[model samples]
Target: MKIKIIKIVLFTLIFIIMLSCITKILQPKDDGAIYGVRTFFAQNNNHNSDILFIGSSHIHCSINPAILYKEYGISSFNLSSGSASFWSIYFYIKESMKYIKPRLIVVDMYTINQGAPYPPDFIFKRFAISMPLSLNKINAIRMEASKNVFHYYINPLVFYHERYSELNFIDFLLYKGRKNRYKYYKHYIPSVKVHLQNEPNIKSIYDVSKLYYKVEEYYLRIIKISKINDIPILFIVAPYVLSNEEQRRFNEAERIANEYNVPFINFNLNYGDYNLDFSKDFRDAGHLNDEGAAKFTRYLGKYLKENYDLPDRRGDPKYYSWEMNAKYHDKDIYNIELKQYTNLNEYMEKVKNADDYVIGITMLGNYQKNDRVLQSIATNFNIDNIYLKNASYVVDNNKLIYSSDGSNQYLFHKEIGSYTDLVIQNGQRLSINRRNYIKTKNGINIVIYDKFTEEIVDNIYLQKY
Candidate 1:
């Protein structure tokens, strides 16, 4: 019996070794370094952060660390991922706390909704690569690690393989062999362009019963962990496109928030009175654009100043990055162009005064059928020695003429017809043609196109003017 027991122990050790070797072989090619970097940051004692924000894309894009430092004098870092789950959040917080002692923890509560499931791909990748052998990570790993060793070990396809495809090796080499940083906000800004008037009345995309149970279990565990660690927890619901079902989910979240004994700040519900423009402030229905992020950050800064005891760490040399980041925020010249035109009259004047420009007309839905609006703008802008470039699409009847380059491709199914609508007012047609184009739309719209030759990129919209 003793011999058999010894043999069993030896077998287990050998199995573990083989598993570890296999995992490395099948690991993701691109984001493998990301996991390594995250682990390094978590374990390293050199860098210390005061405030650490963790959550999904909402946390990363919405919370600008520079803004926090500049406005409140509080140093912060956003350690967030797109579609991060409860398990991921718990592990991330655990790992991060090993390096940084945060005064406050802002937890996004959107993950609690039944509709958003814990992303298994990310959780598995994080577990296999970076997750420590502690009780927490081990438990999580054990729960997610595939039972089929062959699938886990030999199949490189099982991992997040697409991440490797997206890598730009040139960019990576230029940046000292580090992977390119994913731009969380490509164009949009976070701001309260639309206000939430009444209690959010959202409908659930998932089954209410199942979602409530899962949320309760996950939330309670998080609360218990925070309580034991003496960490102050702030629950936040980031802004998103809301439907009746989503509003219902928020209602459920509110109940859980009260029970958890944490401060629940529903930015989605509270920002109604702020008069937010949906186009200028959001990158998508759920995420904020840069402008939106600034507004949200300012509001959050004010909130922290009033309610929290967070200290201003601006003068400290250790927080120099914050200052640098703050300076870079204002370098975008597009914001200046937007401020110059408050109304259509001002916009028209600027267009008239320009020498050479490109005019792009975007039509929504069926607007392409009626080219009245864009035709009129084209006629009005007709001047000698001036260029009038026009692109039109159908959105029912309203033809919108946008002055930009032809390269601005739509991401959705919008009929974008690029044509130079010349109005010969003073004999010479306006020369509205340019090789370079600046994006005017605030939000990121997904353009659909033909699969084979990649023809006709549609659904592109303008950024904030």
Candidate 2:
């Protein structure tokens, strides 16, 4: 009898160990800011965030907290998910309040018009997966799902069974420690691909007065939560080309903001003030690429400083993390900006002072004339035939020179981050490093960090140009 009891205990222990290993291996990888950073920040956050942002993917991709911290010195975190409804946003705020108190909440209005999809359990899973099982999460699932309560909440294993196929050594080894893909960007995923289209002033027939009651109720709840906590709320509409019908719907959001007496600003209406070039700055009709985000963020940062009582924490020691986050965030921006030079002379000069890199350049075929990608390059950069002259220009001491043996020739662009070797002419190749960012291809991975403080100054998963 004693031997049988001991055998049972040993069997249980081995089974538990195997299950633990499997869980680590099957955990999901970071897809983007919404998919990657929300949980990471929730798990590792120091609860030092002063500003809290909530909503859907628009909030995650548009509001760059690290950029805000760098310029305004206010620390923040983005608690957002893909296709998040007002219902989900309210619950996420509730979850955040359990851990930390923020001075203000910024709400993005992009998802306002769309009603929460029925059977809403799966949409909220991005957040549910990372958060510990708690009453806050339980209540959210109950409200969102309103069915399958047991399968959705009691057992996640059923939904996650398919993830076994996605498992890899990196998932278990975590060689670099719990991976935080967006740690460098402070949760802002920069978009670089440009599709030129202006916001059309088209008339469409969509009723704004008919917004679903559940949507309105959730917005009101968001307002109520802010009032209960006495946390000031601000509503914003990011830059996106909207139809007249969509614009009218956003007017409803404005109306609600006024009813609540909170500050509201629509960047779409004020885009001209920021010098936004629709042809150059947007990743698509709806989203602000990294370049557009920078302009809007800088403008908003200045406005917040002038209007709000945000403090600059640059010199404070307790908030040292903010500075480090800002450094990494800036590194991402520098990497993108470096690839955007429209002038060959300027581009070569910038590249010369920086570290060595490879640019995948391919010749343009017929019909390449209408290629908007090539046309977007400055008109001055055009040539009848790109192959006639070699682009082997290297920067030496901030000067451009043509070199044959260009094995080790890049050196300028001081303080740049990971790069996405965009096609300087038409067809170009790029490199992505272990950090999963665009750094120099097939070369030594170099990190430009603050050795003095042990903080990253730049990271290029490196962006592919």
Candidate 3:
């Protein structure tokens, strides 16, 4: 009897060791925060976020929190996922609130589709796994277990494994470094140029009835939570190059917004005056590029300033980090140049005289900083230009200026004190101190210099007209 008991114990020990080996093999390598799992976890723990924007990829690509901060002194973060559903939004919000108490919540209505045919289970799974904390992990596990007990228990190997099969060993291995991890409280400011245009097939719409029901539940939950926490919720329908079906979805969303007593801004219908170029402004058909985001954010900032009683966290030491982030993200406006005009006076005169003209202003890669400069210029200039090219440029005092670029020539105006560097003969070259600028076969290179240091800032490529 003693020998038999020992044999049984030894066999059990060996089995356990084998299981452990298998588990380790399946376990994901932790490289750093860029890893999807790590990024999700790190973002949830971000404490400096004062406003949380949640939705699908649309929310992530369109709303630049750093831009918002730069313009209005509002701290915000984007808590969105690709192909995110209502359940995902809800869980993200629930998890996010644990780390930061936001002043406002912006919920994009794109995911509130009522016609999608897929089951909510898949959506729930996606969101559940995205959560990083232990409590959220446990909650997600329980939820999954209740629905698929066999998969949860019998398939332990499969259940515990990370979902990113596309990531190779190197990718996972690289993420193991602590430096690769995302800074939990850090804010990202986008510097890439964005273009806004109408997407092809601006009339397609999809029925989201089933999806709407699920979304409705989450929306109500968010509203309830916001009310209890004294946080205001703003419902925004991000503009996209839409099909007829998608346009219809916005109409339905408007109806739902009224029913829910939520303030809704449907940019698709309201921002007609902007005459956006969807192709240039979007990363895809649905998501805005940096340029589009800047335009939309500027509109939002002005709207908030005019309509809402939003707090300006500027100069408040408690929000010093946010302020610093904004400043750090701010672009030096002197560098931006309008490649189309030959002289600052000419550009200003064209801006004052023309009913419509395209203004192309290039920034030094920071979207938020560019937006602030553009806003300043827009507020100050009387721009009647038809197509505003690039992401950042503003009309002021009946003259258009490159507000975000830091080049001294662009900042100085012969007539109006200082304006953007002049583009001679289209984009051939800029006439900084020179009056007659010419473009070579290789094209005109407008080299802008710094003001205080006199260092070469940036070169603008222009074509001779």
Compose the digit string of candidate 1's lDDT tens values, residues 300-383: 878877887787888877665555545434322222353345565555454444322333333222223234443434444552
lDDT of each: 0.50, 0.59, 0.52
TM-score of model number 2: 0.68
Q: Please provide, for model 2 over 153-229, each residue's C-alpha lDDT reduced to its tens digit, 9 standing for 90 to 100.
A: 54556656878677754565442232333343345677778889876653343345545678778888888989999
Stretches off by above 4 angstroms in model 3 are 1-47, 114-126, 133-146, 149-181, 184-212, 273-275, 315-465
Model 3: how far is 308 from its true place, Å? 3.2
Between candidates 1 and 3, the TM-score winner: 1
Ranking by lDDT: 2, 3, 1
lDDT for model 1 comes to: 0.50
Which residue segments of model 1 deviate by more than 4 Å? 1-47, 115-138, 149-212, 273-275, 328-465
TM-score of each: 0.55, 0.68, 0.54
